[model samples]
Target: MHELSICQSIVDSILEELSALDPKPKRLISARIVVGEFRQIVPDFMKEAYKAVTKGTDVEGSELEVKTAPIQGKCGDCGWAGDLPMGDFKCQSCGSSGLKLDGGMSLYLDNLEIEK
Candidate 1:
């Protein structure tokens, strides 16, 4: 699944970041992440991906915790703001298809638990 690649990227970036630490971490315990609903990520799939990709690596056995945010949109013309259904970008109240997505398009590792 595509989540495998995403998890792999996370591991790679985290390794890069950890290299900057004054004393390198000995083992990774968990990774906390914020994934937006607009990204269409399945949490179960992502967890599976993390398990598979972390095998034989320093991050093996690390837990993946994901927090999801809603797909929010803001109407430019009528100032309407609320959650929007995926694939339907139109403004709910104004019915004006002119809406801008304010958030909910992110997938990033927020924090990591590690042991020295």
Candidate 2:
């Protein structure tokens, strides 16, 4: 699963940043991430991946907090714009298929909780 690689990347990035700090953190508490619905990431899989990838690493024992991000879309037909329901590409106002979607495709670390 790609979650493993994603977890590895997160760990690598966190460790790199932690190393640059003047006062290193005593413990990593959690890594909060936003998982867009459009990305179709399984939270369970992500947690499992994090557990596997973090073993023996500096961030080991840290939790992975996942948050779901809604998909936003604009209807070209009705000029409507708002957050769209997942998998529903049509506009709620006009029910048009001419919807331009944004967001909900991202996978990024939102923040890190560390004990200093």
Local accuracy of candidate 1 as per-residue lDDT tens digits, 1-116: 67887888988987777777778888878988889998888999998888888889777888989888888999999999999888898999979988889668888889988898
User: lDDT of each model, Cα atoms only?
Assistant: 0.85, 0.87
Candidate 1 ranges with C-alpha deviation above 4 Å: none
Would you list the clashing residue pairs of candidate 1? none
In terms of TM-score, how similar is model 2 to the real structure?
0.91
Candidate 2 lDDT by residue in tens digits, 1-116: 78887788878887887788778889889988898888888999999998988999888899999998899999889899999887778999999999999888888888888899
Q: What value does the lDDT take at residue 116 in candidate 2? A: 92
Ten residues in a row with the worst lDDT in model 1? 13-22
Give model 1's clash tally: 0
Model 2, runs deviating above 4 Å: none
